[model samples]
Target chain A: MSDPAAVPPLLDARNIACQRGGRMIFAGVTLTIGAGQSLLVRGPNGAGKSSLLRVLGGLIPCLHGTIDRHAPIALADEHLALDPDNRLEQALAFWARMDGVDRERLDFALHHFRLRELADIPVRMLSTGQRKRAILARTMASGARLWLLDEPGNGLDAASLRGLGDAMAAHLAAGGGIIAASHFDLSHQFGTVVELDRR
Target chain B: MTRWFLPLVRRDLRLAWQGGGLWMPVVFLLLVASLYPFAVGPDARLLAATGGGMLWIAALLAALLPVERLIAPDRDSGIFDQLLMRGISDEMIALVKLIAHWLGFGPPLMLALLPAAALLKLDGAAIMRLELGLLIGTPALAALGVLTASLVAGLRGAGALAGLLILPLAVPILIFGAGSLHPGSGAALKFLSAISLLLVAITPIAAGAALRAGRE
Candidate 1:
């Protein structure tokens, strides 16, 4: 784990406003998270939770706001994001190559998420929980400082949920930041929750 | 700009080969050429006279075949979103995809032209002119195919719209490429090359902007 004191904060958002499909979703939001910190975005369905993550990920622009980040970020939404037809290992390996993740770290990330055994299977074969873990492994493998997860605990069983929790703890211990949007109560681990509403 | 550019191309080529119906365009080109003789009643002289222009039209239509699925699948599946999060620009992704698309369809279309020419009863000189015109023109077709796909990929009825969008952009290439078949028409070939180069230059930028807009 990297030392939090030595590492800079991973993300900052000030006076943020977001819109989707020509309507405003959230406005006047502000937050900052540094290394080893987590920001939990809590919102009900259609409350723009996913849209906020997309905006922060820079896939869409924020209507009125500013965000600053000191390091690269990773995102794992409901979508697998990996190539569906390719073997899971091959698909993850492609991102690993692009992300410059070393062999040792990649192997460790796979092991951490219990995906090492399913690595050779095609992504289309994985069950819902397994696919979720695989996507998490991809984010972990990148070794990015900030992780924007739309729903980190959607299809996981009890064991996998605990596994995800442990992984987030470990990531924070290693000076990474997390901004997760979930209806589930993960505030104990995340420590700071920002609630959104339907409007 | 990452070391992933080559790997990206390789992956796309494989997808185009295995999942993308890579041979469909070439097959369509052949089918269109084959229909020509039957429609014109198999008069060798008549087929010979009209064959080269018909082939050019077939090639233009063939270029449109791959447009519907070109960018829509990857864009819908979150691949581009993932790539964007990793700091890869849409421009780079579009450029690599353009190259891969050309490699997948361009050479195969040219190769199939030989048998198609024979089917049309084209003479050696006509075949050579057709081949030269295709060689210079297909890259532009490939570019236009991708550029249209990017623009229409996120829209409803993208497939139907893509055909309508690409036909107009392809008119210039068709005029020059088919025109080059006439004797003493070297100027047409140069014009075809200029049009092709312009298309090649503009597609990446336009497609990149389209991709970014589509995400919203």
Candidate 2:
């Protein structure tokens, strides 16, 4: 237990196959991500990148095979999933409360994501880039061990991207792992890369 | 580990209030009840006789007013996916939503009944029976509406389909509730309550399964 290197994978998927609206998007996918490690999922559009993440997050059933998740998961997808009518802090607070997060983590996440200044603004009032940042802030404060990031880098500015990188680094340093589906180059290195080729 | 259900319920209530969901049904019920006296030409005896049934019909239709918005908006917005990721099951979500929906319209509908009864010239006894029937029957109405909303949340023609789906399931409550006012049918209230209890119990499971099936 003393050596983090001795830790086993926090997430292990064995031969996962999933279908979306009667099409088998991906098949025979296997991947393992351990504590303090990250997996990069790369594929062209319509290559089942989002589907694979959904399967991993248990939003949809796996058409075949199995998934073993040793810890809780936080997923950030194309949808910011925040109520547009609510203020930025209120919208995030709804999710934070659901995740059983406290005020301190919420403040920390807002600071790290550079959203503290915009906290009082309505979500619908934010720019697309800022809204995405709000979503990332929710994900960071979720206290989940596995982060499933779907196109996390989309709409992020260079500075915000670097901040995301630092957040990922800190998360990994604390024994959490990330599985991200992204077309953009990630600032943090990954221990494993999974390419889901278009069929 | 998720305490989000209460927040979810509170948010839904707040949204419903702001969105006019809370008042739409009440006004709709009032309009339907008020128009009935003119249709029957204001014969006090006949109006009292038929007004109770008219009120029941208005309640049923009013229960349906918000079905189109109940669960579809959240599902379409991918909020359900976020909830599932947090280890909260769809069953719990459906249950919370059902409660929120009932709170949104049920009491308001009961309060609307007072004005509706007066417009129909319902006698004192008829008014008492009507109010009690609504108290027992509105929960069943809410359950059916929520259940139908979950069933057709994402499908084409969902609004019409929900109306079609709910009417048949709701027939038992309708019959028993309206029958409670009839002569020599004191037992109708008990049957109405029994049906309401059954629907309330089944909603969480039925709606939860529908949501899971939708993910396919």
Best by lDDT: 2
* TM-scores for every predicted model: 0.95, 0.96
Measured with C-alpha atoms, the lDDT of residue A172 in candidate 2 is 94
Off by over 4 Å in 2: A2-8
- Model 2 - which docking category? medium
Tens-digit per-residue lDDT, B160-206, candidate 1: 99998899989999999999998889999999999999999999999
**Chain B TM-score, structure 2:** 0.96
Question: Chain A of candidate 1: what's the TM-score?
Answer: 0.93
Off by over 4 Å in 1: A1-8
Write the residue-wise lDDT of candidate 2 on B1-216 in tens digits.
335767889989998997999999899999998788778898988988888988898899999999999999889877888998877788888888889999999999889889889988887888888888898898899999989999998899999999999999888888999999976677999999999999999999999999999874
Query: Relative to the true structure, how large is the alpha-carbon lDDT of every model?
Result: 0.88, 0.89
Interface RMSD of each: 1.1, 1.5
User: Tens digits of per-residue lDDT for model 1 on A45-115?
Assistant: 98888988888888899989898878899999987877888898888898899898787777888898888
Extract clashing residue pairs from model 1: none
The superposed Cα distance between candidate 1 and the true structure at residue A51, in angstroms, equals: 1.2
DockQ of each: 0.79, 0.75
